[model samples]
Target: MEFHLVSLILAFKKDTVGIPLAEISYFWGQMGAGKTSIARLINYCLGGSIELSPALQNEFVSAKLTVRLKKGPLEIERGRDSNTVVVKWGEKEDAIQASIPARDANGELIPGTGIENLSDLLFWMSALVPPRVRKSKTKADSETKRLSMRNLLWYCYLDQDEIDSSFFYLDSRDPFSRLASLDVVRYVTGYHDEHILDLEAQLDSLRGERMAMLASIESLARVLRDVGVESEPEIHARVSRLRETADAIFREISQQRNASVSERTTVHALDGLTAQAQALNVRISGLDDAISEVLHARDRDTRHLHEIETLSIKFRRSQSARAVLAGVQFHSCPRCAQILPERPKDNCIVCGQAEIDDIPDSTEEALLQRDIKQRSEELKEIIRRHDAAIIQLRREREELDIKKRRVERERNEASARFDSAYLSSMLNKERERSALQQQADSLAAMARFPQILDSQRQKVGAIQAQEAKLRGKLKDAREAAEKDATNINTLGQLFLDCLVRSEVPGITSSDTVEIPTNSYLPEIHSPGIADNTVVSFATLSSGGKKTLFKCCFAVAMHRLATKVGAPLPGMLIIDSPMKNISERENREQFEGFYNMIYELKANELSATQFILIDKEYTAPVEELDLSLFSRHMKPNDPSKPLDPETAPLIPYYLGN
Candidate 1:
């Protein structure tokens, strides 16, 4: 997979800036000259989060990135205030809206939003398949790890802050960043694929099953021990003893059954006694039920009568209070302490009007009294009905009780005459025999205990065998991974070669140089250096050395990918690589960096695109062909403000 940046358009409110990209383009200027902003805008258009400067925010409305993928060209546009990206395929006006840190089903931001997400879309355009990597080395599962284009971008972009650091790839202090860095390296180096990931997932599942089987076997053994059947021999012995005891009981029951048939003449008498006893039991149950019903009714009627009596008392008190108030005459207003005019004795005092004696009306007190009288009569009727019902139910219950007692006496006499004592003894013996038979059957079921144990052992054996087979497969996978180490080593050697060509101090070909297989980081160990020396991108002291090392390493990886036909996006944008270098001290090393890049253009890396952003032109830049120099903006060039006026405008596509 290969992707080349064709151009970038930064559209401002009043103006726009268009930057045409080449194989080796440089945005060289002084500090705060907006050199880094160009690189940031490119990244922003590619679905990166951006914190725009006040100037850029006020000037730029949106940024657009145009790239030529293997399939065709694509244009991605993004506004300054939003993370949404609008992508347009070649010659297609229909824009696709997408964003980064996509929301999941629960509407929470998670990596790899969906098919329309910028990361996945870019991957699709690049023809690169996303690979799986362990989220953590300690927990390796299919569902736990993921490698998206967003994570891969960490390697492709180097901001000014990180260009001189020894740990160039350490974008943040997050644990996931470190893991993702390793995974991205593994993926781009052609060391991981779907088949490897599938094998890992299967191994994880198999291990889980094996553990469960072991736990089950342990639990079964414990249960067997609690039942006094710890071993096969003990189980067999118990079974034999139970069988003998059951057989002896059965023989006794058979003899008793045979002897009981001789007493068939008494069965008729026994049946008559049983019928009499059953009739008495039924009569007693019905009498008890009737008594209960009558008692419940009496209780309910008593509560209702009490309520009626209370209501009657309350009404009588209310009438008494009203009569007393009606007799009193007011001489003055109590509230205002004012004298009142005299009135007739039968007049209504509240309304200051004469009472009409002929008016036919019942007062509120009279209505309440009538209601109380009605409720009292109703209560009295309920009491009378309850008392009568109780009396009748008691009479009926007494008669049934008398009949039941007489029938019971007769039933007992008949049972004695029929010799029920002998029949009862036989029935008890039969029940005991049935219980013993059941116990024997239960013991006999344990005869297969040895087979069960054997089955468990076979299961464990099978799991172990499967584990061994998977181990062999894993070993083969490791071997294949080792074989792929050559590609990384080749890149590492190229890195060392570039450093030597750039004349970096204390760096030589004899130095042990290689990209650590685990970290996928370039490590160099010079002679006489301490055994514990930290030799990594972060530990490089000289700024020029660090920048040169990072550039060389990136170029080496690009070359290796092309050589091995690996899926790389085929574009690298380095920002401000001249931060720590002075022309007087490191002119040769600075020139060597660009010279190496220029040399690779004539070789297999010719198709690769490199965007270099720095503060000034080095020796190599002066010697390089003028056509290779893309865009150079001065600090305050009136003719070429960071936001140019003649650049093409970003269309209002997808409402962005």
Candidate 2:
């Protein structure tokens, strides 16, 4: 992608200033002349956060940025006090207003009020597919991961404070930011593309799945505690014991049935046995009714418990939202733009609704908290009731089972004693055996729960193995990418060449320059220095050397981008490159730096635009090619400084 800044327009209350950009536009002015402000305005209009001076803040109403992208030209306008931006695409007169709010209001972004965000439109217009980078090297699946044009701006722009800093290339001091900076360089150098991006996405998804499965395993452990199994190994051991118990119970039932059959010949009256059976059946039917009632009560309590839990969650959320709203202080009416009048501490600013006589701020938050507490207590009570109901249901079922067993024993005794009809007694014994067989089957089924848990554990383990494999593949891919010797050598040579051309003290073409494969940062080793002694951008003694090294490294990266056909933004803005260098003492060195930049733009890297903001040109303008510099505001023209008269001022209104 080729990105060039055409102009930056600062709209004042009464007048507007349009700053035209060129291949190398120099905004040379004294300190506090609004030179740096212009650079910051360009950044601000491009979706950056900035703190403007009071003078600029009061004078400027809005800012507009015009850039010529590969697709077409785009005009982006942003007001000082509003979050909305007006984006005009191509030559179309119809501009689309997009919101890019700093914070969400009313569940929507106030700035990006529409479906498309400023980033989306910008990336689309640039014809560049935004790639995803890891937020941290330690955690590839961090949800905070994002890579956009705004992040890329750190590489393209250098403010007055950052031009000579050791970590100027980085956006922040955090380790994650340093890694992200390296990734940005890698991306712009064509070392990363959709392939790396896809791999990262896949790794993220796999990690998510692995985490979810691990969570499920934890939940399963909690649930299985009710069945007395605490872990997978425990479940396996319990399954073995339960299977043996089930087998022993089945054998015992068979033995008892066989013993009852042998004693069937001891005679008794069939009429008496029939009367006893009828009485037993009536008792069993009553027990069945009682068990059914207990089951119904348990189901009702369970439903009530679910409802209470849901209500508790909702009440908690409502209480939190109310507390947040209660602390919000309104200074003005958003709809009417009226300044809110100061009221009593307990009175509402918008509606003038008085608070409770003895309460603070408002009673709403306290009331909501009370409601949440009440709901929490009710939920606990419902849970207690549900648990008690379950215990009662279990007791009833156990008692019913005992009664049924007793009736079966009585039936066996009666059949063995009453042998007047032998065939009928045999048939009755067969029916009793069938009922006992079903009860044994039910017990066996209950015993199989451990096996089911074991199966689930196996499934979770399989997924974990797959996740590990995917992680390995991702790691290998990253390592292979970092080991690209060709890119490292190419970038290293370009960096060294730029440093030599800039005439940086103690650096030459023959000096050992190494671009660390991991960080992609340049390191210089002088000829007479120890093998372990490596000089980096931070180790340089002179501020001018640091600034030159920073600029040269940046230019080298862009030059490499062009060579590799990477989608570089094709623009670089540097502020105060010669802040510490004296024009009288280092005039020759300054001239060399300027000439190097001119030659780079005029010959090799013509597509890339460079904006340099400094105090003044050290060399003659004609010698450096007058066409190379486009002059804007110069605060130190004839050694003049900004004073009260020249600074932006607001008019006072007279009383009527």
Candidate 3:
């Protein structure tokens, strides 16, 4: 299989946007007519999953990306909610799923009319996460958190328009990127390995935060002993005195304090119902808080805006000479009708006075794009905050209402069957406990609490030792953390230095993604990067680089289709490959690229469609075009034509 018409743009070092693909197909246009825009569309259609805004910005991204061939019905992950999956193949047909899995009564994933291979890509695209929550931290408490990722592939393209490596040509012995050769001649034969000395430094930072929690428990225990609860010599008389005082208070309450006789059930019910009502009120309050937060912010902003508008209008009107005098009576010809001196300078138009107390002003398009953008963000943030609050309020309110009703019923049942004098007796008991507490306070001066006996003191000492050990551990963790931070900083610097040295690998580097790193886990560099002898088109001779770019692009498309795991649709479209270099080099490089594609097919990693924009360079290539495409044209310089009939020689089709 083959591919045709795939274009993509990669960012270049300078802030210049060009059509890396357009130059080949564009024989008659001026330099830099934004040919990379096609690259953006091609990437999008290829299922790169680029954000709409950024994808649209490709033309302005200083990357001369081209879209020469689109190869698959590439499967992609939908929005941030990773469970959902979306697949795009051409401009027709769309599908959506609540999730990739649905279980039957047997707890087995049910067979469904869902996408194929899409699940694998989706899982990988989502980094293969828990499908359901295993902890309270999960959004769904009972949700299954399982991830499966396998059989994933991705496409890669070369934007060789930005090459940095020095390579050897037949005439030039130096190498830029041998991989640039369309003919599969050892592009990247050797490999490099990045040392992991940097990764060890990162592990120390996580150990330090665990130590702080241990220190808090120790301080709490110390405070527990300071409140007259420590062990000491006992004062038995003080205890006797406290007992006597409680007895005396009990007698006094028995005679004087009489709580009205109320059934126990009724009291319980009333208290429970009251609690429920209070909870409901709390829920309502929370809702009100959320609404108020948004409202208050909106109102504050509106008021500020009004004040500004008023002030701006006044300033503008005063500054405008016509505005200041609209209210004043002025003759058509001031000098012709009256005084040599018209109205006195600085005099108000309405009255012959310089001072004007207030003036109204109007504004148009005052809220510029920036202001609108900010307000929109503010509004969205408030809405998001409010949604969480509203959910919490509803949950609390529902629970409160349910509990309140149960308590109310219990109270009513108890009230109808009164428990009589038990209520009075309970009051006497409460007074007795209070009197005992007061006497105990005085006795506490002796500091003879049994809870703080010598045995208990020993136990407390052991706790203190344990706490100290935890502290020591925590200190070690902190040291580790600091060391790790230092390593990370060093790694960051090294990474930047490497990028600078590589010179961003030409505009093509954007197509080359910086493999993602996991901060929470041990850093794992890409095998390609760790083995630094990597392949790039830059090492190719100028002619070879262009051919290598096309080849890499083809390989990338093939990879993306396979990675998506979905059956690909349509065919690859290429507009005149092998047009950027001399005929000899172009033929040699094209031949090499074909050999590689043939090898991939032999390995059963191939299924593709090809469309080429050939300029009728030679019969070997021209005949290939004729065999593939019904529409073939004779080549001529579009800039300068040979015959009058062939005035418009170049059919500017595939936006080079």
Q: What is the lDDT of residue 166 in candidate 3?
A: 18
Model 2: how large is the Cα RMSD against the reference? 18.7
Better of 1 and 3 by lDDT: 1
Which regions in candidate 3 have their CA more than 4 angstroms from the true location?
1-42, 49-543, 546-580, 584-586, 595-656
Candidate 3's clash total is 65
Write the residue-wise lDDT of candidate 1 on 587-621 in tens digits.
87667776777777656677778788876675344
Per-candidate TM vs. native?
0.55, 0.59, 0.27
Candidate 1 — what's its lDDT? 0.68
Worst 10 residues of 3 by lDDT: 185-194
Ranking by TM-score: 2, 1, 3
**Model 1, runs deviating above 4 Å:** 90-116, 140-144, 170-173, 197-475, 528-535, 618-627, 637-656
On TM-score, the candidate that comes out on top is 2
- The CA lDDT of each predicted structure is 0.68, 0.68, 0.37
Clashes (N, CA, C under 3 Å) per candidate: 3, 5, 65
